[model samples]
Target: MLFSSSSTSLSSEVSQVLSENIPSRSTTLTGDSTQFQINEDLGTEDLTNGLPKKLIQLKKLKNGGTTIKKAKTDLEYCYDSLRLYENPYVATSRDKKSGYSIELCLDNKYKTLMFCDLQLNTDFPVYYDSSLENVAENIERENVTPLQIRGKIRIHIDRDDQALLITSQSISLKCFTKEYACFVDSGTGENTSSSKIIKELNNTEFFESSSYPKQQLKVTHHSSSDQKILLARGTYDYPFTFTLQANTFPATFSSFFGKTHFRIESSTSIMRIPSKPKGFLKFSKNENITDKIILTEEIKVKRVLPSTNMLKFEMFQLRSYNAASDVVVSVIGNSKLIEIGIPFQMILSIVKKDPSVELHDASLAVAQRMAIPSIDLKTMDILPEPYIKKSEYLLRTVESQSFDSDKTVYGFCFDDVIIPNYADGLPSWFKTFYFEASSFYPNYAALKVTHLLLFRINYSKNEVIEGLEVRKTYRVTVNFPVFVGDSDISTSSLLPKYEKFENISDLQDEPPLYSTVTVEGDN
Candidate 1:
């Protein structure tokens, strides 16, 4: 009776269980019938508990995290989830200088999940990470946990001439996505292949949160009530956990962006103590006053790809034409989809190569291909709008080992080992956020994102086709119009419905309210 009879397959299971307990003509629903039959098809046990099998299956999934479950997820707003200031996060920055870092240690099936903004995509009722807690129906909890900011700091004391104390902490998250532009500059042009953030997408801050004073700083149950802490000479470790307002704020369309970034900006108010050292130490003449220091660390967030018009993955196969010999290339991966933050692995095979060619280096890159279809007014002809294309690479090596002549051995690149034929596991992380973050973005916009997997075989050929070929360098190019995003696993299928939808102009022209906030300044 909990779930009224719906078209779901559970109706059939309930029917079979019901027939065994009551007569065919009996309208009353009860187990007190004078007559009952137990057969092999209906099971040997008598009816004791009236719970259906569907509820039992859900009970098991609740204990373990299940992403993209069948049930409709209910959003439950939560705040100040944890106060973790004791555990030290894994220290990074191989350099000797003291610094800080953080990692998203998740308990879900996948280490990294996607996050969408509420304002960007207004179509569907998208759920937040908080829903994974206990908001979803039946299952009282999420398939995984969220947010553990683990970090450490070190300092050296030469007789404690001056003191440093931390009085407070805070964090912020930012989002910046754009479509097309020209003749513009905003500081990101150089690194992004001359691409600049459109004036419309410029955001001061998407989300800001600061630690509350009532909550314990170092420990939750300490007898003393002081929240401030003093940094003694040597090295000490610490961690902080924060809660994000995942829902209620503006969510995003399923599109993805490299510029969209989430990071922890700890706002700390520091005070210097005026003290004379025991020996030859020096101190500043200025009196001690509380100043501020801002520390930043990169964190990853992605929207949950529900079981709807889910993302797709496929085998990448192609052939490059050469009059001398045809170059056949096929790349395979363990999983169906290519997700970000995971090492990408592909089995690449090539055949019928020109004998004089020497394979030197190869790389896989995420190319966000863009073009606009339009009509020429003067010519009265159709032509694709010209959008200059470019690609970027950070040096990654492909380790090779002896194998059958037909196939090659490739492993991930670690140190500066020579890379001949083999490729390291997939370098599928964001490629500076260029991969297919969503279903090629914007289901309703002409400005859309298309992905291309460019596998270039860098080699040197002895024989030259042209008379003036001085360099003798050649490239066997293989291109795959590949797909790399989550696919649906639902019983039937559902379209991603947008609860709210905004066009380019409306979103850009909208006014944003401002409030007062404390910021740091240089002396």
Candidate 2:
């Protein structure tokens, strides 16, 4: 038998059934003995009228309560028949201009004949009216407004236990201009017609502004059936989508102060089992789900004190004493204590002793190195085995500025150097090794784990070869200690212990601040 009804009548019937069956308050079941009443109006109708009966079962329990059971002959059902098996059932984005897509799957037992009317609704409460009446009117109009749209499509589905891809619909937000005005009530005044405009925020002007996007879906199932018989199907599209809108704040204060919510609703037509025509039956169910679409990304900011003494390092005479040119390198910055996601600057200066030396093709690099330990098996002893250092470049420069011609000073400045958020690895630790200070001094053992900053410089020198000027290569390497602790370490904790001074000049009168230093021969 063919079953059909108007959209308004079907909506009313569904609403009635939902209101009657759904409990208003929570109830607990104790004993099994119980009995409940099922809606008799939902029973199957006579086939002569071309209408099938909707069978509903109510089983009695020992706890004196009743539970609703599925009808033995009910084949037609609403969206409750479908299930969601994918994550992000609702896609989200931060950019206001971005769009999103959704995927849905059908139950294995039912096959869809066709989808009637597919509607897409975008609601932005902050920018447009989101009242129930307005929403209903918008859906009925089926116009493409800045916040909502209703799509028309005709698609057939026969797959089971597979996804029904709906890739055509994409949701996005747009900017528009709105006018705001302030009015005063003219109750007992001279010109008491209604109200008078006192002031206006925008002076009736159009100002473009953007808002968040909240998308919803509505689909109509034409025909769906299982192995036994076909379920209820008709021409009019059913309301398959749930209420979805952008979040709002307290009306007492702010009107738009919350994240936008995107909703995805999947539903199936009400099903009726083929049974002896004795009573009427009606059933409608749907699933409503929502997710938040972030409008902006969050950033964390932190502040830290600056440390001077322990963070500075300088290396004098980086090359051999008898080299053609001498280079002195110095780095000034807070290295012992560093915070992730904070910007800081470091100063690097290089001074050449001889003014006559001309350097070309100069480059400098600073890298963080990791030292791994190893043991010697032949001697059955632990030896100072520093593995091949793995380096991560922190700063690099191919250009430098010269300060003076008399004593050439080249400086490279690293500005706004930021430690990445994911650099919180293992902390520095000390390793023990036996070393002799000199031939005359006695041997001693020392334990230390040092964070070394490798400074490298490469340049070319002008030389005469075979009665012609030639460019010869020259290189220099310098190592400086950089005490790197955890990213959360504070600068004040690494500073030397001394009394606070009232002013910069008074700091000289106070005891000098110093940190312990361990000196060992080069390995």
Write down the RMSD of candidate 1 (Cα, Å).
26.3
Give one digit per residue, the lDDT tens place, for model 1 in 278-353: 2213213323344433333334444333333333232333446545563445555433334333334555565535
Model 2 Cα RMSD, 1 decimal: 31.3
Residue-wise C-alpha lDDT for candidate 2, range 118-205, written one tens digit per residue: 1223342111211112222332212111111222111222222111211112111111111122233436667776443322122211
Cα misplacement distance, residue 76 of candidate 1 (Å): 34
Provide the overall lDDT of each model, using Cα atoms, as 2-decimal numbers: 0.30, 0.28
Backbone clashes in candidate 2 total: 43
Clashes of each: 31, 43
